[model samples]
Target: MSTQPTTDVAPSPPAPSEGGRPSDGLQAGLKNRHLSMIAIGGVIGAGLFVGSGSGIAAAGPAILLSYALVGALVVCVMRMLGEMAAAYPSSGSFSAYADRALGRWAGFSIGWLYWFFWVVVLAVEATAGAKILEGWIPAVPQWGWALIVMLVLTATNLASVASYGEFEFWFAGIKVVAIAAFVVIGLLAVFGVLPGAHSDTAGVANLTAHGGFMPHGPGSVLTGILMVVFSFMGSEIVTLAAGESENPQRAVSKATNSVIWRIAVFYLGSIFIVVSLLPWNSPSIVDDGSYVAALNTIGIPHAGEVMNVIVLTAVLSCLNSGLYTASRMAFSLGERGDAPKAFARTSARGVPRAAILSSVLFGFIAVFFNYKWPDTVFAFLLNSSGAVALFVWLVIAFAQLRMRAMILRDDPSKLVVRMWLFPYLTWATIGMISFVLVYMLTDPDGRQQVILSLLAAAVVVGIALVRDRLRASRPATASAGGVRDSAEGEESLPTGS
Candidate 1:
């Protein structure tokens, strides 16, 4: 009953720009290479670099399993997303799927919620990256560095899609290389082969000797999952960016297919090296980053500062991709009439100028909130957006279930990508995501985040329902008006035709 993959057509038409031509809209400037690195770079983020420290402390060496658990979750979600993205690539891929499979309300609500999450991400990453930069150059205030970082990336996005691709290719490349080098160098040190390095702390013994691998008990592995799970959030950016790629289906298929190894090598691989090199309980692990701490323990000079540079690279890359993602989602919403029409318009260079600026505008406000209230307004916004990853995956699972049935029913020939194990695995992924949500409700902090996210999601859903109802009623209202409406309709008809 399974249908084989097929060549994909151009993605849905881009929203008309100010010039009234589609060419003025987004261009397929992203090459396959860019797509590959974007996916790789998206998965290996600040979470693995910085957040892993807390995760190790919470669960000790067994934090690896927590990552594996979450990585499996990401793998499942990405596969489902890729199936749809490859079949019919769109900038609004998931939301569009929700629209067709679930309903416009699903699409509109999920689309806006997803956008909300990334805009908040833009603020968080900017502030994080600013700290790294401010460490090196004490002359500039942290806020000034944050502003500078945001403005630079915003301009990169506005310049053109190719510019964004080039920047990310290099940015992600550095991250890829840095982690890879760390793995190789760390392994060499572990085996006591590296030059000018001590290896007393580097061995498999460290994993068990410190705290028998599960220092905080098995409950802490779940706690570690809570601490480290958000690190996997940005892996799906490839599909969104792939809509503007030369071969959207190929790019998507490759990225989705390779996700496992990418997660394995970059995440599991580096974490394994770090833990093998130093005991999980080392105080330096938290003070410096996990990788930096491991490197310093192995006698790598200035390793903490050096890893800070790579972390800075990762932070900027995340911020750049965040702006790109939020704007495209907005543009998709505009094209579907789910958002203000201005967001749909692109510039002469095929950049969605309005969308980028608008996304950044909110980002600036979030930054202000971060500065103004560490615990009040900003905290709520942060938590409200925090739980969106699981919610999004849940939507994708359902959407894919519906999407699989649709592909099988209506157009099996267009089924270029199919979810693994069909309805069974789809349901499993859904159940797993639900479990995480319910689990969140048990922790006070997690409960606050889940509750706020739900409230926000509900508001977005309400707006979507009302907006859709008004839109649905417009034609009936127009029809009820008689000859004036007929005259208006006639006037609206294409003149030349």
Candidate 2:
């Protein structure tokens, strides 16, 4: 198979700028505030609202440490990516960086895999959002809500990038305020300060009183890690969105540098209060789910209804980001000739209309899978794509390691948002990712999904290798009397020519 590096030079072929729009299509419309909120909103998803209950149940309060561990690793990966992004910002983000620092195959494989990951995520979020909306308005079927949600977000994306930014900013802002309020209310209830509050159930003792922090033992910590990683998947979108900012470098640096604290405050801090106010093994905790249970425990009025709205918002936000990320990745692949050229075309508003439509269409199909085959097809889709989080994380680590050296070699000044401890931290992050993948193999629930995801990744990589070989084997030129080479490597020239 041909593995030519994308950066390898073979005579200049004139600039693509002549006929096509500049490589920065549709992205130039995003503003700074839109970017800042997207970074925040991307990290807080339905996982935080709903799935945290399972993690808390499994790991007890020690789930906080699980989130912290994963958060630290993400910080390292994002920092490395931010440094590279600042030096050479592009819509492709890691894929473009991989092409520059790694090779064509690396770019082709990771770009497609990342695109697959987000498209599946788009469907998952849509299904989740539909369920909540259906719960509120029972007259509409779940599938109907899913269609409406997908169509609405598709319209938002088909508009200018600025429209998307504005929509996401408010959507994300509401969730942020809700979580912040939860933290405050939970703290007051814990301290016996709020009216109608009960304090008998508060404090760190809740961590060990139920069954010790490792209630299910250290093995369950791995299980918790599996769930925890999914929540962190959207954090990388900041680096991707940063490419469109007026000052790409500053946007990346700011987002990467602050991720550590954001995780601490949003994920760990909120979970800490949840477990503090109630025993980890409480039936209500599992029955009502973590966030609702915590809110109900503090006697907060309308806690369930309030959190339902928040969770729904989180799901819609994820769907919006998923569609945006997937379409942008497809657009990048088209520009690099790895995908159909039509996906590369952009509207006057800079929106990648074809790419957006394609992603939304798949999302609509996934909603069908959710309704028609929730037990089989939907489960398989969830499991197969589950392992993609690890795969994408691994690619980010490798891309950063290679890109960092090139950036430092060419221009050291671009190291403003540098990773700590250089190669050691980078290698360490890779080790952690490897450990997570290995642990997935041993876990009963995650094993099949991990294997399926690995198989999917392998298939994509194989296709990339075969495509490279075919391109490499083709004749260099059909002109200059260089006839097509035949079976024995002999040129067959036209008799007249």
Candidate 3:
């Protein structure tokens, strides 16, 4: 029996443009290889490099279980997202899907919130990358390095989508190679097979010999979830970037299918080597990062500097993608009449120049806030955007549930990608995400982030509701005129009446 809905609407809504909205000027400049590397490399984050230490400390070797849990959540979410994305590829990605499946309010709220999240990330990654670069060259100030890095990536985005893709390809490629090599070499040392290995403590027995796996207690596994969940933020970026590829559906399908292995190899595989190579409770794991400590255990030369280089690459890759993702979301919102129309316009090379500039403008302001008011204003920005990744996954799951029916009824052939277990897994993903958000309230930092993020979301949702109400009250002629002349650029509203 087919699980798909049988009821059909005659003459369904038109399919959205693929590989960029040609009607409004987003272009198909990304090649297959660009998308391939983005998907492969996107799974590994700078957080995995810098943030995993505390998780290991808290959960002991059971931190691996924490990572595994989050990885499974992301896998389920990606499968749902891929189902919709493969059916109707859009530059707007999940936001667009929300517009179609849920409502304009959903699309508008999530889109702007997503944009806000990445712009904040811009400041975080810029500061991180700048700190590294300044250490390498003491002559250049940290702020100057931040400015230089932002300007370089901004120009790359404004040049063309292809330029962004090419840069990301190499950046992601480096990360992929770095992690793969780390895993293989660390594994070699773990089993005492490496010829030059120095540390006698390197062995698989380290997983249990230190404190019996869950040293602190099983409760710490949930704590580790809070520590590691955000690292998976970039995993969905390839779905958004796919809209600019030569084959959006094909690109999305391929990326979605490969996600499991990518997470398994880059995240779980490397962390396995880390824990197996050294005890999770080792002071070195907490003092230095997990990866750096493991490398040092085996007497790898200058392990600190080597990890620094890799961390810097991850930061740069994140900053580069942050700009691209934020601008593209802005471009998408503009096209749907939710934002200023100038963001919808594109350059001759098919770059959304105004959108790029606007996103970077906010990012620059964020960078300023980071340096000028690190505690109050910058902390607010960071906390407010912290829980947005969870919000995004929730929205994607809901949208997929609604969108699956629409696609099946309208044109089942467009279902190139399908979610496993139909509505069952989809509901399970939603339940897990909700539990995570609620569980966050029990922790101090996580509680602050959730409260601030909710406040931010409420404000956006309020604005959207007011706009919807105002549009509803206006006469048809006036509504049309308002779309044309209003400063908000609410033209050609895509949300169905």
lDDT of each: 0.81, 0.76, 0.85
TM-score result, candidate 3: 0.93
CA shift at 6, candidate 2, in angstroms? 31
After superposition, the stretches of candidate 1 with alpha carbons farther than 4 Å from their true spots are: 1-24, 476-497
Question: In candidate 2, what are the lDDT values of residues 77-183, reduced to their tens digit?
Answer: 77877777666666777886776566667777888888888888888888888888988899998888988998898999887788778888988999899989988
Local distance difference test, candidate 3? 0.85
lDDT of 1 by residue, 175-291 (tens): 999989998998888788888887687888888998698888888878878887789999989988987887776888899999999999998889999899988888988988788
How much is the lDDT of residue 165 in candidate 2? 85
Q: Highest TM-score: which candidate? A: 3
Residue pairs in collision within model 1: none
Can you give the TM-score per candidate against the true fold? 0.90, 0.90, 0.93
Candidate 1 worst ten-residue window by lDDT: 488-497
